[model samples]
Target: MFLDNLSAFLTHPVTGTVLLMVGIIGIALELLFFSSGLLALAGVAGFGLYFLGFYLAGFASFGDLAVLGLGLVLLILELVVPSFGILSVLGAICLFGGVLMASSDPKEAAFMLVIALLVAIVVVIAAIRTFKHRGIWNRFILKEQLTMSKGFTSSPDRSNLVGLTGEAITPLRPAGTALIQGERVDVVTHGSFISVNKAIIVVEVEGVRVVVKAADDQPNH
Candidate 1:
């Protein structure tokens, strides 16, 4: 009888609704507060478990497959193309659809949604515990790991601004604009805001950004 109750509890409408709420909240927090540490990983894991539970409950359907496909595509797009919100929007839609499809009934779907949401909360909490002081994750799911996998790739140098002298087109209050070699470029000052049109000398060159200081302050140009 306990097994029966347990099964019933798993399918309970209130339980599912709670899960869905927690999942959505987790996803929202993860996406919005990206710097919130391990929240993002927790969100992903929560979404996975939510659907996995629904599928195991024999509530899956054709719609769930479509949702899974769309989710995967959207997820891939996120990694390929960096954007502010496209990935998040598509991800949410796909996740919602997946939950909806997996449930045998609307009631079950609702229940699963709640459960999934709760799972997201738990994952987030756990992630916070594990990754609190660590650096970025940069994994496939997190994308932090992927960046680390690629290592530090230097940017291309298109501008031959090295060893060139120019004037400040705009005051760089630490980061400002300076004209070098007839081409206007952004530059960093040595904690001094060079006045506009101030004669500046390039001290070092790295990638596109040039470091500059007042021409008079330079010991060697």
Candidate 2:
């Protein structure tokens, strides 16, 4: 007797459609080729389709509401709480139970499940395409910027400064070159300008030049 009733319910068109949609959705989610939004959409549509089919088949409205509420709660929990393994399992249970509760016949519920899977699958594919096209899903997501910010520094070449400090390189007519460590570098005189080769200290280093000042006063010649 139960088998005959189940067979008759499965023959319903609405039941079959929901079942197909559910299968598709399940496959799409597993493959990761769809977006979350698409999944949500499929869930909503699948729920509605199953509910309508059962209502048309003469199920009591009150029981249907209770079942629908449970399904909705499950979905809400999925979004509100961290998965924790419990939310997903509970949500699936609630959803399946809700469909069975809402349906006038068990076979109709099965049919709707299949349709729901199919819908889920299609939506999942669309979701994947949507994400890929947005450029967010690409391997190299960031394009290097041409303009660099301040504070960026590169390593200096130590050999470039090999002999460029402490020599009487600058004449100090306020400006001239100094030979320090065997290299010529521009330097400046501090306080009063002095002639070249009167003993100097490296006052500062700016780029290729080591600025200097006379240690003591000396003859202009």
Candidate 3:
């Protein structure tokens, strides 16, 4: 009984399109933000519901599911291991292909997929510009502005601070301010928390990122 209703609803163009949009957005959120698992779950549920309905209605074949699964696996692998966008592109193709195969009408499904993809892109852009959520984009997007083409020789010289010891003026719960070389500079520890007033030393400086380590943690020169 419930399956019948679900099948009917999912088969409709409008409802199905909405579901697809929601599913894509959810998946984008899962990939973009590194936070609570709720968004990821919601995205998974959207895909699950969409496919389940199609399966119950006999519109989705094992081949379609296999394609979608393969696509998703590639996308996840892209995140876990860097493939320089190769995996991402391939994954998106398979994902859309699978969804289109199970769709009642290929035309409507393609149109709807484009819309959802656009919306998801907008969401990602907004998230990148507005919030500092520190998600997958940090890895994917290049943030350095000081390049030779831009009239700057290097990424804002902070290399002089290397080997210099400093004091954490603020709590470095991995990221905070530290007094280094007589300047209050923004800094980050090596994935460890250093309490206020703890001794620290400059370790690595890449581009604008300043990495510090606990003074005691550093080996003797």
Which residue ranges in model 1 land beyond 4 Å of their true spot? 1-7, 61-66, 69-81, 107-221
RMSD in order of candidates: 13.3, 12.1, 15.4
**Compared with the true structure, what per-residue lDDT tens digits does model 2 show for residues 27-48?**
2353243344475566566556
Best by TM-score: 3
Quick one: ranking by lDDT, best first? 3, 1, 2
What 10-residue stretch in candidate 2 is worst by lDDT? 155-164
lDDT by residue (tens digit), candidate 3, 1-221: 98899898877777766777777777666666744656656766666667777888998988998998887777667657768779878987888898888776778778878887787788767877777547766766677776777777745688888989999999998999999878999999879999999999999998788999899884669
Give the RMSD in angstroms, all C-alphas superposed, for model 1. Answer: 13.3
- After superposition of all CA atoms, the RMSD between model 2 and the true structure is 12.1
Q: Tens digits of per-residue lDDT for model 1 on 1-221?
A: 66545546655566556556655665555554454536445555555555555555666655686786577457545545656668867876787777777766866575556566566677666776776544224432453444434764456563466567789988778888887778778889768878888989887776766788888774656
lDDT of each: 0.65, 0.56, 0.79
lDDT of 3: 0.79
TM-score of each: 0.41, 0.41, 0.58
Candidate 2 positional error at 129, Å: 4.3
Ranking by TM-score: 3, 2, 1
